[model samples]
Target chain A: MNLHGTPLSIVIFALFVAAVLFLSFFFARKAKSAAGYYAAGGQIHWAVNGISFAGDYLSAASFLGICGMIATLGYDGFLYSIGYLAGWVVALFVVAEPMKRMGKFTFTDALDAKFDSRGIKLAAAISTLVVSICYLIPQMNGAGSLVEPLLGLPHWVGVILVGAIVIVIVSAAGMTSTTYVQFLKGGLLLIFSTILVGFVLSRGLSTEPVGLESGAPRGEMTVQATDSQLLEQGYALLHTTGSLQKYVRDGTTTWWKREADGTLWRAQWTSDGVVNGVAGGVLEPVGRLRQIGGMSEAEAAAGTGSVGPLDFLAHLTHPETRIEQWQKQAVTDEKGAKYAVYTPKMVSGTDQMKPGVKFKVHTTTEKLNFVSLMMALFFGTAALPHILIRYYTVPSPACARKSTIVAIASIGFFYVLTLFMGLGAAVNGTVNPADNNMSAPLLAMSFGGVLFAIISAIAFATVLGTVAGLIVAASGAVAHDLMDRFGRMDLSDRQKVRAGKIAAFAVGIVAIVLGIVFRGVNVSFLVGWAFAVAASANLPAILMLLFWPRTTAAGIVASIIVGIVSSLGIILTGPEMFAGPYGLTAEQAWHPLGQPGIISIPLSFLALIVVSLVTKNRRVAVEA
Target chain B: MLHGPARSSGPDPASGYKTRLGVVMFIIYCVVYAGFVMTNVVNEGRAMQTIVFAGLNLAVVYGFGLIIFALVLALIYNHLCTRKERELNVTRSEKGAGA
Candidate 1:
């Protein structure tokens, strides 16, 4: 879909960017020291930090990517919601309180707290930089996606726009501005989503409006519509699958789509077509929710008038209801020319809600990939460099605990809301084939343009909040951990801040380039790789340092190095990087599973234990 | 009442209980979540997606249940740990005064 910027949405976007810059400058006045710059001088209130935690944690991936996934793929998208919330269980139980009690400036500070080894510092700092940059790329990608639709700017401009804004935001006030920005983004996302869900429930479900009819034969069934009628309908007619071209055909309003073989298929008002060699009544998109399964013809006609939350999910589970599902297929035309087509299929509501729809787990490789993604998400939250650094912004160990709990509550609530929002997008008929990231904002457009503009602005802010945190962690790795601690720079406080700012700018530019390079890949999918890398590299060292009594400094360094190298090795050769971004076929990729966590996580732990045991005698000898 | 801040290391009795409670909660979470994965693998998502409510499947409900379960378990841990810390501190103060 070629999305033109509405004036309201562009203005809202400009105002949001201006507000974020103002916040950076406002917070910059107080960030005079290393503590103030890196950790907000450890003065953040637990409540504020808690919301900020939600802010930092819920990136474009969570808001846009997950919603888009759910909208397009049914229940599979909600799996991320579960896996993401589960990670905080690790953070709260194994990480948060202990992290505050130990570390001062950075995540590396915590990793090297006990050994004070230069090797540990160097390894941890490098892993932090790697994880932060990987995480930064997705946020930038999401930004680029948003800029095209909201401001009508190109994707690269949006990527650069977010990159420049975030560099200034992080380099100016560091954690202080980042935290506040996250707080704002988190709060608004929840509030607006709740409102959107409210609209979904109240409006209930309906098919094509009064102008459209049922059982009008299986050819072209387009109805003449004035611009006022389209506005009255709220959103443009959206199809779940292939692009719908609305025009007159044989004196009737028609929705036509061209096949790869120079043939045009028309979707009539009567849902009848032979899809995938199966003859069935197809679910046509008329910018309204179709009647669900288990609903009697009359009851469905009544449209579940103003349902409660339970009623919404209950209605979706009915076997009788039909859902529009988009399936991607590569087909060769008569000339042997290949094109990727996203064809919409009318799926049983019960089947759409089932597992096989999105994650076809019957295949062994798919099962392993699914489990690997879950593993990464489960362990990754505590290990993420940005998330770990947020723990230090609060004052006491207990505050860290309380904030973790508060964050769990806030984040958990937002995730629950994501299910409804995703479903709302699915039913509201705005799952653009070109950009899944715009689903939530497009769903907002179904309500009104004003709401659409606000949601788009908030979604952009979501990227800003997350990217700023990533830059802070990356810069800290360069300036504090690498330069001052391991590089033996002997830098003053002023010099450290300068080094950090420079690192932030350099990293921001790299992020912009990568974001442009990988434009249409789902942000959440990229974050999955980031999590796998973070868990594999960082979690093993953190857990062992805190738990194993015999953890040697050499063991820690060796394990982190092993974890980082192995995961990156696997990821670079993996299917997603090779076939997805690199334009190679799946069989051409060196590795099968996209996520490395199921392999690399245990490998790191094993490396730590073996290396620690081997160096046990050395530790005793040194003590003597 | 605002319970006092958590103790910062140096061998307080409360740290042991906190660690124990944390381990137990983590283990429970691990088992339940792993069980979720195994069920999906073994049954291949059929058992989980079976409709349990009016038009709501077990998969959706169970996923939601896991999220709420984590929060409730966290609350229980916080409560138990805070109470143990308070009790141990009271006992320590009494011994100190006598000595």
Candidate 2:
């Protein structure tokens, strides 16, 4: 999976980064006032804002994390995609137009729009920074992962590089630069992903170095097809001594080993040469598809040469098709040795297309995790500080609605493409199970080096765009919501812009440190935590402020505080954060599930309602 | 210290229609989405994963169906909301002329 700074990919990545910097400085000339810096003078076209929304939403987690999951874990990965896109529906229908009508700049502007209360502003602003920082961790983590393979640099270098670049991008022109960068990256990601999926369909299925249907019982006799006979009896020896000698017999290398069960197995024969980006002659054609299941009698005889997109799916669901599936388990030997091992099984495509492969749904607690994660995704989109602020960038309420629809279309298309990209990686041998974040880019490499380079570059920009958006939101919370409103700085527009710039740099530095601190975690998994916190803290206030007339400012403030505290508290004490942060075994972690939304989201709403009711009479007394 | 509900705030029909439409669309969306989540909860994904359409499993197709279905609803709501906003503007201009 390590490209090791392949010259072509590195060049492409550098050029793309350079282009992003140029765009930032180019737009810097237009960022004059606080309004222009924070919200692009509220003049962006709905279409541009819509595409930027797609760019911002489709973070490294979307492209890299989901693809890696799909590659390694089949349909379980698509669950994330479905949950993410479903969240957009809430954004478009419930939050978009109303947010535009209400807010001027930061997300707190929307919350404080009616009451103009300092308590509300402080609470919501703090929520913004908390959610933004949690979200920033994943983005920076993605950046670090990309750096090792793409730039041949240390993980910290990648984190610092992206953190510095994003700080400059936000400080230079604020949202204007971030929007254009997102627009460019989003459009490129979609178009390139489509092209990659097209290549997958054109170079259909194959079984190079094929085994006895892949999942034959290890150390047991099974029927393997050889040309000399219709079917020959053989066995698989996964582990052997002497570094395994390779023989070039009949253009296929065979490895021999003595199994404890006393059976002989031969490795599948190889077809020397390259066909449609698949290279042979080498033992591991990492980019070439080595196995597939479910074919007609004649099709099996012919070897599925190439098929259309529909045919690919048809072959996938044929009930006979077996996909290459991998399972990882942590094991301890009788001698007390512990290590994680991966076993690859040829799974039925039907099973691969189902829900319970990676994230199980059998146990009640597991189901709770699934539902909570989905809730976080659903309510989190509208409440995300960066996404809410985008509603302000457009001109009118209708424009906000229109832009959201456009973002939905673009995002939906990309999610569909992720299915193909991930599936293609699964069968094509491009999946790096150790690091799922590398799956999409490595899948691109399986096709061609140029495709790999381009995808990795865009993936880098994907990180930058999302990071800038998050930092801009954080900086806005700091400068406008906290300092200007609550601190009563009463600064001029020019001074406000300067304060925002300085805040952006500081937030960017903090993100770099956190990104370096939390390495090797899946970006998408980290993002789920952010969403849970955002849904818990920010969503109840926004939803009630717009719909419930009796929603007192005290309720909004209390909800924000409770939501942020309880959700974040659960995450920090959860299993995922236990091993490193708390120096405890995951079994010792207190939270039952990693996702806190199922509990925290309802609690926020309850807090808002109860506080509002009790405080309503107090408000009346004040009015008298 | 508080603004009243949309209905109580002088009966602006555009805002009123928007509020109603928002509620209905949200309810419909919740039902459809909750059906997907609850299917997994109830059957643990066994019931919906049956092969129903185009030889694809219901879980796969239904998951995708939810995504595209959301876009279609958004487009429809946008069209209706735009028309209502225009109607409200025209009514206001006519009143201005009469005054």
Candidate 3:
């Protein structure tokens, strides 16, 4: 759906960008030293650092993608929220303290803190670069999408705008500026989402929702007509396959499903406002209730006046409540021209609240894929390069632990709100079936235009905060690990900060290009792959280094290399990638698993052990 | 030439206690999380649809439970570790000052 840029949204977006730039410039003076640039001088209070973690982690994917997924697929999206928040458990329990005590600047520093080997530095730095770049693609893409509705600009313009703004943020002050921006964004996101959920609760559930009446306009004309009558009104029969017939008139396509009695029922896009032979208004905006608590149609029209949080979920999940769900089907005409058409089906509230709708886990491969995704999400948190680097921004191991706890409390609360916001959008007739990404924004618009503007601006800030964090991680990899440590350049602190700034600019440009190039791909899928890569590559190395005393420099290097190669190899050849950019059938792909974590994670651990044993014996022989 | 300068050489006094506590908490979470994934996988979410508690199905109840549980565990873990660090490290520091 094409979204128009309102004057209010533009003003809010401009103010948000202006504040971010102002923060960047303000902090520039303090970031002249390498330590200050990379880690905010390791003096950020635990509370601010904690919320910044949430800001950095809750990328566009968490807000837009999860809300969109939940808005459409129900419980499946919350599965992501659960997995994502669970990953922090690993971060707090396993990686947080050790990473803080050991590392000085970047993720590589923590890994090489013990062995200090050039090989570990090089391997870890390269992995950080690769992972950061992969993660950057989705954030950049989300920025572009947001810009279209906010500023009425093209996607590339949005990509370039975010890129330029983030480059300035990273180069000007680095972590200091990045932290404050994230803290602000994280705080606003939580506050406004709570307010929006309040609006949802106040408005409550309604069977006969006002705005888009059952996705069809109210009191519109309708008449049952024969096939002859439909054709007489200039509806061309596009194709007839099985019980479904496709038709087109004036570039508007519609579907007709034949009933058992041989009568045809039509479902078409409502915006076209085409009604001939079919009803004039039956194809309305969807996502309203058919019935609540077994009420009659007349009684249900009264709607639930207002509900508390628990009451909303209880009523929505009642078995007697029927929700209008829109399912999209890919249809092809006689000419083989293909497009998607939405058809409405009534689903029980209980069924919508369950898991089977999105992920069909009956097949063994599908079940394994589901489990693999959860594993990646569970282990992926502590291993993420950006998240790992956040540890160094705190003063001590104790502070790291405390900050992680703060992050968990705030993020968990916000995730619970996602369920309400998503269901609110689902039942309020606000979800745009064509692009579920617009669900949250549209839901906000349902409350009022001002709330919509603030939410959009916050969503835009969400993108900026995450992208800046990624760039900071990527640049630290280049300047600190690769250039200074691995290459042994021995640069001064001033020169090191300058190198990082330059690297930030270079990485930002690359992110912008990739974002525009991969515009139409699913943002969540890319993010999932990033997590898988992080879990497979970084987790094993970090874990073994901290816990395993015999872990050698060679082992860490070997594990990092194996982790990066295996995960990337699997993902590039996996089913999703094959079905997507490669333009091939999913079954034709080499890999069976959609996620690489289950296999690659273990492979990395094994590589570390085997390499360490062999290297240990070799060192003994050399000494003799 | 293979080794770079290490930041700190001696083992930390609180390291042993903290690692043990962290590992235990990590294992507990992993087991609970695995159960959630397995429940959906085994019966094709049939178990998830069954109303488990509070008039909510097993899916809604368990999914929200996992999120809230993680935070609670985190808070508990942080509190315990902080207490241990104070108890263990303060004694070591006092001994060091005497030496």
What CA RMSD would you report for each candidate?
A: 7.5, 7.0, 4.1
Candidate 1: misplaced stretches above 4 Å? A209-290, A336-338, A520-524, A620-624, B1-13, B89-99
Name the lDDT value of residue A93 in candidate 1: 88
DockQ for candidate 2, C-alpha atoms = 0.37
Encode model 3's per-residue lDDT on A1-624: one tens digit a residue.
224678988999889899999999999998988878998988888999999999999998889888888888888888899999999999999888888877888989878776667898999999999889888999999999989878889999999999999999999999999999999999999999999999889888777655443222231111234688789999888788666687778876667766566666565443334332243333343466778865677767877778888778877788988876767766665777564566556688888898888787989888988888899999988899998888878777788889999999988888998899889888887776666776788788776778889999999988999999999999999988988888898888798999999999999999999999989876568788789889999999988887776778888889999999998888888998888778898999997878888889999999999999888853221100
For all candidates, state DockQ relative to the true structure: 0.35, 0.37, 0.51
Best candidate, TM-score-wise? 3
**Candidate 1 per-residue C-alpha lDDT over A439-556 given as tens digits, one digit per residue, 9 for 90 to 100:** 7887777677788889999999999999998989998898888888898888887787788788888888888889888776644556777898889989999888888888888888
Q: Sort by lDDT, best first.
A: 3, 1, 2
Writing each residue's lDDT as its tens digit, candidate 2 over A1-624 gives 236677998899888889899999999976777877888877889999999999999999899989988887778899889889989988987888777766778888878877778998899888898888878998998898888778889999999999999998999999889889889898898899999898777767654323213331111222223323311323222333332212234343244322334433233222224311235322222222323555554555455766776566656655677665644444433345342433345567677777788767888878998898889999998899998899878777777889999999999989988988888777766665456667787767767678888989899989998998999999999998898888888888799899999999999999999999888654455688778888999999988887788888899988998898888888778887785466678888886677788889999999999999989964422110
| Model 3, TM vs. native | 0.92
RMSD of 1: 7.5
Q: Which stretches of candidate 2 lie over 4 Å from their true place?
A: A209-293, A296-303, A332-338, A521-524, A578-586, A620-624, B1-13
**TM value for model 2:** 0.87
User: Residue A264 of candidate 2: its Cα lDDT?
Assistant: 31
In order, the interface RMSDs are: 5.9, 5.4, 3.2
Question: In candidate 2, which residue pairs get closer than 3 Å at backbone N, Cα or C atoms, i.e. clash?
Answer: A293-A321, A293-A322, A294-A320, A294-A321
lDDT of 3 at A248: 77
**Lowest lDDT block of 10, candidate 2 chain A:** A215-224
